[model samples]
Target: MTAAERIARDFTLLLPPGWARIPLDGRVPLRVKNLVTERVADVPVEQRETLRAALTRELTAVLESAARQGGLDVLLSVAPVAGQPVPASGLVTHLAGQGNGDALDSLVGTLAAGSGTSSVREIGVVEVAAGPAVRRLTTRRERVDGQGDLPGGVLTVTQVDYFVPLPGTRDLLVLTFTTPIEQLAPPLVQLFDVMGGSLRWVTR
Candidate 1:
């Protein structure tokens, strides 16, 4: 199989058997719009569009940055449950070259040093189907800024980043999962690990 085909299959097989997939580029905008509408319900209807435009711009920028790092992205959504533990989901990014662990470590460290509200909790190498991967966990506590309604509300976020270098090709795969601290249970974290370990890059 060609590298592209191999990578496509790798992403498809990454998801657990029955999960549903969502196109981030297509759904993100609509989701963001809904969020803005719900959060700013008290605002004058006429001005809602203006507010949405601003919020969407900011959100799109952030997502775009991440998308660049992962040339291709895989996003998923699980079936609904009466009370789901946030329906665990993640983003996967693949690039046609290996990633540098030392550089990533330094970059993460630098980010932590500059941000008073964020910290790097752990950094190390772990084995995944692709090969040895750099794993880093980080924690950040920030206020929900633009949610005009939830003014000053603090939110703690936990994020795990995995940098996997394909066994044979100079390619790399980046996987990331972020969840609110309140919803990041041990079980969910374990599920993330298991899903990540199953990433196989077939080059045949």
Candidate 2:
């Protein structure tokens, strides 16, 4: 049997409580509305509708942006991780190739050398439940001026990307974790590390 035939085409991830997978379908608006409603359920009834409307609009925009960036699924977290309340999010994407670890390493090297506002904080191979994977941490300073409802300022976003190579294939499944909460980066990164370690390949 060929390598592709011997390997699984699917994988699974374990997300903690309060982390939700946003569907990238035509019904995204509806899903956002439902999520907004649930999130504002504790607000005063008199101001619930207004708050819901505002949150729905904002969240819809975020999800739409994720889709435009080739994200398969956008995961949003609003609860505590590692015993601290830290709001963060993630995106899953795939890259198809025809090489092996050497190819992945070359790709990583290219990424590390790319010029941008973002800087690579760390890059190395880490063993997870699925096997060896390349982990890269980066931070970018984004200007929030004229960017939707965000206030005018430089927003520092911390991101961690895991490039997991499929067994017997050059293709990779990438998990990207990001957060604008720079003050809580250490714990948030730890949470991302745990999440990445939980990834498991599913067999046919």
Candidate 3:
């Protein structure tokens, strides 16, 4: 390829997964698709390469920065009861004697007679304490498939899982890193150990 060809081709080289070439509204307008879940967002022509490059550089820098300040992201999802905690069924019952009593009373009486009234009124109320707080780790290595932190030829991500405190709370944390599978060695272990040591009373 000649110089001009090389320059033109460089327009789309080394883009991360999930990013596709897109037409833009301005001069030299092109964008990469976000490779993981969503397609790479539209770039403002001037920022595509900058954003991608920054994603590469900033991911490592951010992780290192976070390590210095302490804490990484943890995702802990909890599925609560499917319905609303407070049902409005009894609200109508309690206010049955109020202004619009006749219709509400009639509806309640009919429903009660049917023996299929909202049992939600009787379900035990258990207010779960505020759970953990996990933040999204802004990763510089934006592409899922490319760029890893592997060093010394030993991959051990599956062999590891970790939890951290939510900054200033006792609530536990869970999160995943954008770092490469092979790269989670000392720092990963260290973070896990530190959190584990601090929470030995709560966690076994």
Candidate 4:
């Protein structure tokens, strides 16, 4: 399999019960479980889709904390905006900046520091748009780290990944952020059991 596909497989293991991945055009489906009802639901997109969740605010703060301690890649969930039919533009700044790895790194840092590392798996059914869709984000923070080969423009970077059931319903939202972020899938699988058997999202 291609590296990206492998990454996708690795990441899918992170989902919790009731959660699932629904394949929509231009979307990488990611499914999650319902917290209370034990119902399963499908998240429309993957990649930065978790950012599309409702917990963006809370997650930003949590990841911010975790990054301070070590590297982080979070898998969290948030409720979706019902009937809202996710706007072509996400509520959160999905495409906030478009530049080099430093710029991306900075954005990640800021998100991590502000939100702190979060383990909130409450949200579900979020719409996400990565690469160029987020046109109106203001750089909350910026730090140039010229240490690595690709010195990142660190922003206390933190990624808030959230999942929510469809129709603004309350369900299990899973959030986990730490480095080796590539390991997001397995944790998510565990998350499924934690919440209860839910949806098994379809993979591409």
- Estimate the TM-score of every prediction: 0.58, 0.81, 0.20, 0.20
lDDT of 2 by residue, 50-169 (tens): 978888887888898998986667888754456664568888876667336656577667668872668899987788898878889999998776657755877789999888888767
- List clashing residue pairs in candidate 2: none
Per-residue CA lDDT of model 1 for 1-204, tens digit only, reads 465425544543356543533335556667656655554576688887786777568546655765565535544433334544244557776656445544555544544465455677877677777556777777788677656565667777777777776554555566777766545546656767777777666554
Say which candidate scores most in TM-score: 2
True-structure lDDT of candidate 2: 0.78
Worst 10 residues of 4 by lDDT: 87-96
For every candidate structure, what is the RMSD over all alpha carbons to the true structure, in angstroms? Answer: 7.8, 4.3, 24.3, 19.1
- Residue 8, candidate 3: Cα error in Å is 48
List the candidate 1 regions with Cα displacement exceeding 4 Å: 1-14, 21-71, 85-87, 95-117, 146-152, 167-169
Q: Candidate 1's C-alpha lDDT?
A: 0.60
Identify the runs in model 4 with alpha carbons over 4 angstroms from their true place.
1-11, 17-56, 80-204
Give per-residue CA lDDT, model 4, range 1-204, as digits (tens). Answer: 333222222223334322232321122122222221122134434523453454344444544443353322333343344433211111111111222332434434444454434433332222322111001111123466686587656443222243222111221222322222223434533443333232233334
Give candidate 4's error at residue 2 in angstroms: 20
Q: How many residue pairs clash (N, CA or C atoms closer than 3 angstroms) in each of the candidate models, in the order given? A: 1, 0, 15, 97
Error of 4 at 177 (Å): 10
Query: Looking at candidate 3, what is the lDDT of residue 17?
Result: 26
Deviation of model 4 at 186, angstroms: 19
Q: What local lDDT does model 3 show for residue 145?
A: 39
TM-score of 2: 0.81
